[model samples]
Target: MSKKLSFTVKLLGVAGGVFLAAFLSLLAAWFYVQNWLKTPLQISDAGYVYELKQGQSLGYLANDMGVAGVLNHPRLLRLYARLNDANKVHAGEYFFPQGTTPESLLQKLIKGDVILYQVTFVEGWTVKQALAALEKMDSIEHLLAGKSSADQLALLALPVKDLEGWIFPDTYSFSRNTSDVEIVQNAYRKMQTLLETEWEKRAPNLPYKNTYEALIMASIVERETGHHSERDQIAGVFVRRLQQGMKLQTDPTVIYGMGDNYKGRITRKNLEEPTAYNTYVIPGLPPTPISLPSAASIKAALNPAPGRALYFVAKGDGTSEFSDTLDAHNQAVRRYQLNRRSDYRAAPPSAVGN
Candidate 1:
């Protein structure tokens, strides 16, 4: 072969070799990136919580995680995210478990799977108790803090001054930085909706002049007993009392009226001292709800059981004994209240579920 031709062939071979090496390098990089994307994060057993602020991009998350040493090669993850059209990430708190991979993390953000904090308003809980519970949730932004109940009521824009039974007793889940007012509003809306719906299906001859009156009665029933089986019976007793123009004489109302003064037990004088919430002194239902009522209690109030029961006494075993006459109630009170057992509980240990 000619020298010039041989030189040209060598040059071509060198170029081809360079091109092959480049191809192999690119292929290796591609595989490395794929592996990196699927690799589990280097978070501790306790895991890591990341709060993505509003309007933050996926690239920000990648760089942030890389800086935190949760994963190496955040650039590759960012590239993967960009290529997959997953640059949009929702803002919220996210928990990164030990075995979470880049792909899964990205998916979680894309799907807006944020950490949810729950606040529960228990049945028979007073508004004060509910607000206290709400304030304890660190994730919620407290707008009601350092404010009077009246001020908080105004802030919430509620029609009534007293929240009382206005909020539904249930577990409410919210994302991070959720405002306290928002949560209370949600609970209020839920309660209003539920009450309206239940009010529509109320049993005939119900003595409630309006839904609000029924709500007060429901709150009374909620505080009277926690037994799901006895809710209707308890409601029936109170309903009959109202219909017969008799006094409710429930202790919970008196305790509510006592407010911060109540140590643990009620006294005869406490019952006699008339307060707006004391059903013992009030001829009919209390001026407002004394506690948050459960949906079951509301249902019971609207649809009282068919019975002649006019009174009930707590059996001290998370249940109540109902009677058609005052004498039976008095007997039950003596048996259960006078000689109460050491393990006596007016309500069950768990009084949440139906």
Candidate 2:
């Protein structure tokens, strides 16, 4: 009986010893992971800004962070992330402050706390011009010009066949990972919102078939005049010509058709050329808009000033003369364009009135 009791006691002691050893080992590992191996608070050599491309894994991110001096051990960070179930990470440009810890960094990346780049699309830029500007940004170029215009069109929701005049000019902040298509789409949405509001209060007897036509006229007016006060007057002249079934005879349309080679001058020969976008031959609005127009020009198109003025000649000064009669228009043109010895020599009136 004594021998059996002693054996039982020895077995209980061995089992308890094994359990204690296992518990101590686990506690030490937990302490090392949570307290000892954690990153210290210090500015990283990565200089607070880092760009992560698409398809980059967490392991790659840790390697970069380690090289940038943000992390002391890339492998350890990876292990910690794996244990925490942080397998998926987002890609973007991140602005990391000095002294970011591994845990905080992981949280930020998981939450998609990326840096935003501010981009402003000007009111008068065409779709091509907008794309050129976007290309200048290294982050968004790859996602553009993929398979077809159909794929590109899916990004922007504008009604036009292509993203020509839909992008509204405004300041926008985008993540570094923002796709090219998304940028175009954002601009198109903003333009749509603006047009919907303005279309409700359009002027009576306007020649435009709809808001789209009004937008086309507004783009023309934007290119025609730099003077804000003259916008409505210019819009009125175009409206009058359209009602009279007369050609727009605007020089901007011809220049637009010429594309990148426009040398700031539109010769008489250029007007005679047959192009699908040439307003001189097409008569009505062009197939698509030539340029983006400002809100003021859009308003002018929707609510043009009441007038019989069918012709306008830019005086040597910034202002232009509007005339109801052909003889009056001819006299204005002669005074502004023919006589170059006067104060208007800087902008010697070109013979724009016929």
Candidate 3:
């Protein structure tokens, strides 16, 4: 062959070899990226928490994760995200478990699956107790902090001086940095809706003149009940008392009236002193609900148990002995309160809200 022709063929061979090597490198990179997407993240066994700020891009998250040592190849992850059109990730705190793959993690971000924290308002808890609990939660923004009851009420725009039993007792879930006021509002709205619904279905001839009075009765029933089975029975006793113009004379009312003075027990003076919340001293139901009543208590107040029970006494075993008359109640009191057992307790362990 001619020398110039031989040189041209050698040049063509070199070009082909370089092109093949480039193609093989790209193919290998594609396979590696695919494997990376399916591989588990380098998070602790417990998990890792990452908070994606609002308006942040997926590339920023990848770079941040790379800096945090949780991601091996952030650039590759970013490229994968770009190719898959997964850049529009929602902003929130996310928990990545140990076995979480990049594919699952990205899906979670895209689906806005943020970590939810719970704030529980236990049954029979006072408004003060609920506020105290809200204050302690780190995730909740303390909007009520340094704000007086009146200020807080004004902030909520509620038409009441005292929240008291207006806030429903239940577990509420919220995302991070959620305002405390929002939590309170959620609970209040829930209670309002539930109370309205139950009020409409209330049993006939209830002594309550309005839904608010029924709420007061429900709060008393919530505080009095030690067992779930006895909620309606406890409600029945108070209902009969109200219908007969008799004082409720419940210990929880006296304890609530006593406030800071209450030392885990009630006294005759505490019961006799006239306070707005003391059902023993008040003519009828208290001015407002003394504690946070549960849905069950609310239901029981509106539709009390079908009986003529007028009184009840704690039986020292997380239960009560209900009586239809004062004489039976006195006998039960003598048996359960006077001749108390070694393990005497006014309420159940689970009924600590009382």
Each model's TM-score? 0.85, 0.71, 0.83
Pairs that collide in candidate 2 are 337-349
RMSD of each candidate? Answer: 5.6, 5.6, 5.4
Would you list the C-alpha lDDT of every candidate in the order shown?
Answer: 0.82, 0.75, 0.83
Native-referenced Cα lDDT, model 1:
0.82
The CA lDDT at 62 in model 2 is 81
Predicted candidate 2 versus true structure: per-residue lDDT over 247-288, tens digit per residue = 776767777898977765555566677887777777877766
Candidates in descending lDDT order: 3, 1, 2
Best by TM-score: 1
Residue 263 C-alpha lDDT in model 3: 71
lDDT of 1 by residue, 151-220 (tens): 9988999887678899899999999999999999999999999999999999999999999999998988
lDDT of 3 by residue, 16-133 (tens): 9999999999999889877988999898889999998788888888899999989888888777788888878989899999988888889999998999999999998999999999
